[model samples]
Target: MRDEQDDGRGAALAELRGRLAASVAVARLNRTQLAARAGLGRTTVSEALSPNGPVPSAETVAALAGVLKLPPGELLALHRTASAPHVVGDEGTVTADGPGRAIEGYSPHDLEVHPAGPGRIASGCGGVGGAQELPGYVSRGHDRVLAGAVSDAAAGRSGIVVLVGTSSTGKTRACWEAVQPLADRGWRLWHPFDPTRAQAALEDLHRVTPRTVVWLNEAQHYLGDRAFGERIASAVHQLLVSPERGPVLVLGTLWPEYAHRYTVLPAPGSDDLHSRVRELLSGRTLPVPDAFDSQALAAAAALAENGDLLLADALTRARDDGRVTQDLAGAPELLNRYHNPRTPAAKALLEAAMDARRLGVGPHLPPAFLTDAAIDYLGQTDYDQLTDDWAETAYAELAEPVHGKQAPLRRTTPRPSRRSPAPAIAPQAESRLRLADYLEQHGRTARRHLCPPASFWHAAHTHLTHPDDLNNLAQAAESRHRLQWAHHLRHRAADLGNTAALYRQAEHRDAAGDQEGAEALLREAADLGNISALYRLAVMRERAGDRDGAAVLARRA
Candidate 1:
């Protein structure tokens, strides 16, 4: 009976492959072209049509069918027939429909959607007449363009749409609203966030099925990986161009800095660090203005008159600032909390978080770092007045929810270690806190000209783990003419394999008359393929009369 079952399965799979091969031939597409168009790996496409290959999944069959301009239903049926005998038990049985079975990620419709807000607003303005939630979204010019893009995706044209704006600007809310219709239309939404954004996308993007929405909130996390960002960009580009496997909508939101990073063209002869990212985002970004225009304010006024008390309050208060979205999101309350903490220690903590954010620390702030840095922001008299447990008290007060929504410092659960391949082990206690987005943005402009104290640098060096942050601190220290601190920071960054830091260290050594040491550092950087390091090495060799070596290094650069 087993032998007969095996024979039957083999014959079924052979028949499926035969029909698929015939379809590909009819479409005049080779295996490579078919794989690219179907968003399948080249090997996957080849195996699906191979005589000795295993039976392909229903999803793969459907993708190939779409690319070949054949009906997916028929192909899916053939795949099921070929795969049925391989099932060993009831637990192993496969289904042909339903998102849980067919799709591999979250659905936007099922998500708990909320409009842009500081946290969650329990009340509108006065405690007596407050809104339970944010006011209704007032459609803006950019929202119309975003909605049109979503509509195009619904019509079977795969594409990416990125909303670029600063924090608290309703970029996320707009995207959430744009994709809501697709959710009702049976589209699957995939948000790749597990071990890490880049890792999750790279690992599972190839298996993404048709009629799916790739939700990339805070898109910088996905496309900002120094190692894997380009690869993810390439994968997304392939997915968009793959005619058969799409009707897929890639929706993303980015802060202005990150948007500029990915979209800006490199200067002439500079290494194209964001080449693939630039290509992926080309002609796809729609800017979201920070403040509403006259037309948008008028629309908000109409909504406010229609019983949106929250919008009414924002319009009245934002008359001076024109930051209607910020008002609705409780930015004023957040600012008030920061400026008027119950204790000086709490205010100092808020200042510390703001400085850390403005000085290039990642969003996840360590409590130890905050505690150590906060003292720098306080006066000697204020610092001397603190109790032994003042840090604990300040943190608790800062973490307390305001307006029934946001806190100055929001506690966040750290993501699982990206280095670990096994299941995540929970931390013994919460280890990190996040500065509220509204506060972070406010500090960028508020503290842009201020240099952080030595205590801030020390806390950051000891607690911060990301190389980028360390490099940024080193640059700041260099600009302040604190060469010793800069050297320490650059060394720390170089230890973490930051090529830019290595190159900078080389320049510093040369400036200090350590010619041999500079050459050694430059060689290390050149070996890691740092373009600037290569050019520097060429210059050093030419100065030493090693013309042949200089020519080789210049050519390599």
Candidate 2:
């Protein structure tokens, strides 16, 4: 029996060798002669080709096949000769039963590998790691805010909570850690605009398990831009309020200005600066630990001392006018007007401190100057601006005496009655738009996979620009990897009062060989006073044997 098996295997091997040799012999020779022309060496090729010998490595076989101008499968076939009259190639298959004798079969998908390109692909904003656990890094207070925000979102206070800070200040790191525990417990993560890999995870939010935690890095990109913000806000409202879908908990991180622009909170209130700072600390125990070494404590205290003043003044400016928060980021430069050196010393003090070392040593330094190096070392330029600017603005506003008795309170505004209209909610439009924007730039696939435009604005272009959304959809559908789903989204978008969506539906219709249907959708969109939709309807009608209809639509558009 053993001899019979060995003989069978040898026959197979010899056949494979013969086929490989034949193929190689017919091929042109290169630096290395074709394997068929030279024949395989006894020591190496013979053993590899032998029935009892090990099968050649994939790389080696492929190399040999290349040299011989032969298909590797042909060679492999000879090495495994079958007794049956019908010889099955090595790429064989078998099916298995599920729970019983009945079975289902599946084909193996061969993956093609491609080299990575220059630009970055979005990944779920994993994290940059934390500082408390690492040396040479300060523990930013954002961790507390993130932890608490996640708790709040899970508890059902709906809406996005944005974390704002400077670069390398741990906002992304803190958010990642805070959301991980929640994710393990079944919270899904959604990201819209991922300037980096961190934000890419949002693409899967719709398909992920319910009860999600969305972390949008650079969330502003989605919110503050053009057409993108509108769609995103609508999408967010639809998903979060959907009866079928579970709640989507969101945590967005961005620079302070963006956070100010997109946060649900009102712009920093007069006292809200302190509140903001405390909130940033995430209710973490403050009066910071004595456990911290003295130098570290001093540094923190100095920063706090200065920060409080800046916040108070900034918030006050905001109350008087809406522009203060926008200007706060640039307040240090704004104080250039107040840099007089010889003035009364909240007057001269700041400049003296700034110029003290630069001005050279003097036996008699002015007493008016607040020359504390500690303040300078701790970054008190803005803090000084706060104190001086606040004092100037407060005195200017209040110094103008009231008609009667006591001066009107400096920073207090009486509350309105409950019957008054409440403050308008910050729109979710920007956030939604940003996500769409991200998708348009980055999706690709192996073996012909289709993806929607990552950028919401880009996707909305057809309808938005031409009012022929339906035609756009039809055209898109005709293309490889048809974007039918996007067409659906565009149609629905119009019904939801989004003019851009209506226009897109018109474009989709035109693309589907239904110019009349396209014209009708565009008419409705235009009737809604969507100028772009109206214009597109007219153009599409003119192209489709309806010159008079095009003329009327053109006038309307």
Candidate 3:
């Protein structure tokens, strides 16, 4: 029997490793290259291939599948060969005649992974680990939030209570700890994204033995960007507020930075959709300990259950160096180390990301924008391969797809709001269209993969004949979250006597606290028939107590 089991496990590993080896070969990737694409370290991939290397976790396998363009199901199948059933708390024994078969552990209606990229696919998100208690699974303030969430679910009083914090703060483990106590009380996790599963769960509530818990961790994908994402939100809402509720608890977690983006609407105030989303996310939002030390590191190792062994080692090193501070103050430094940029391409990518963050755009640094920065700093290279593999060194928690080809993401860019009655979308679309046309006609650059206008930076340097083209390019830069790039283009346009560009540059300068520079631009813009610039100049003149000049300029209105 033991030989049979070993033989089965060996065959599974061999097959899975075979597939992985084939993918790397087909892509012509070395250890470093393969690691970068799979979002793992070169060492992790190396170990998986080595004879003595430990079995890779499901998350590792899944990430490789995503980067290799292999089927996720195959990795999941491979995971089953190595994965032992996660034991929740203590194994429970069934009554002699209750089910006719002996069962161990309080089975919480048997929770399954969600289809929408469970585990690391959704950026460190997961359903219950079935209390497998993967290493590094720490419970901070566990009793406070988990107990409350479970109680609410049992009583049907709470609609949704999220464990909101920055990434890797042990939010998921806190939740599992809370739910484990109630496993025998009829609390099963139900994923409502599938239409069929959703309907069945909603209809068959009476037949449910324990209550149901809809674990909605790192669910920004469903709420923020795609239309289908909203469906998941709606289904969760139905379960939450369902008139026929029977102890069905809705719990979730989110990065606080994304709260407004997902909860609020672009249209302002409160609309039905916004209200619904807001309500779905309402309830007790418990804060995790958010501390990292000896305990946290151990918890992380345990939580990973597998693939995270390499990461655990890295964290241990960081901890030993005294670099891993108590909280996120040392995050950037730790991130830099974790990125471990050995190659020029990898170093450049890390620098670009760190630069953006230093410049205050790193929090919202989209993958495409990072690619833009990389090309600007490193010249042209194969970023598609780099980002797929090793970008995780810098972007440890990329909640969204790195390719940015998933769907129209909800951008948090500041735009001209609805006061103008003309939607911001139309003007933005026109600007992009105009820029695309200019790039194709003059530069002869055809855009593909919706890649950035790589030549736009060069165009910004050159003297363009048309003012509209310059201003349009500026807007495109701003839309891409490259504020400095936008300012540079606007300054260039202003030099060419674009009045609107002059005003825009003036605003930029003023916001940047270069008041004298702003005043100079405003003076130029006023001469070019910009009324707002004149008004700004008048205000400045008044502050300097040139009352007569202020009156004259103000009368010009």
Instruction: Give the residue spans of candidate 2 off by over 4 A.
Output: 1-145, 154-159, 183-188, 192-205, 259-557
Residues 376-472 of candidate 1: C-alpha lDDT, one tens digit per residue: 8899999889999999999899888754255789888777565666677555265689887667777777888887777887887887767778888
* Candidate 1 residue-wise lDDT at 449: 84
Q: What shift in Å separates residue 142 of candidate 3 from its native position after superposition?
A: 5.6
The C-alpha RMSD of each candidate to the native structure, in angstroms, is 25.3, 34.6, 19.9
Question: Scored by Cα lDDT, where does model 2 land?
Answer: 0.40
- Residue-wise C-alpha lDDT for candidate 2, range 1-557, written one tens digit per residue: 44565567557656765665565456534323433443433333444444555434333455577666677776655533432112122211111100111101100000001101112322422232221111121244545655666676566544455666543333444555566555545444444333322212322233322355554555555544443443444444544565334444655555655544443355554322222322332422212111224444344345435654433333333333322223233232223223322223233233322232222212122222222321332235645645535434433433232211112112222233355476554432211101010111111111124222222223333223222433344344445344654555455456666666666666767888887787777777777788888778767777777899889878765
Model 3 worst lDDT run, 10 consecutive residues? 431-440
- Give each model's whole-structure lDDT: 0.76, 0.40, 0.51
Pairing residues by index, what is the TM-score of model 1? 0.45
Shift in Å, residue 15, candidate 1: 19
Question: C-alpha displacement of 438 in model 3, angstroms?
Answer: 45
Which 10-residue window of candidate 1 scores lowest in summed lDDT? Answer: 93-102
Ranking by lDDT: 1, 3, 2
Better of 2 and 3 by TM-score: 3
| Model 3 lDDT tens row, 188-249 | 55443432332323222222222556655565644553433455555566555544443456
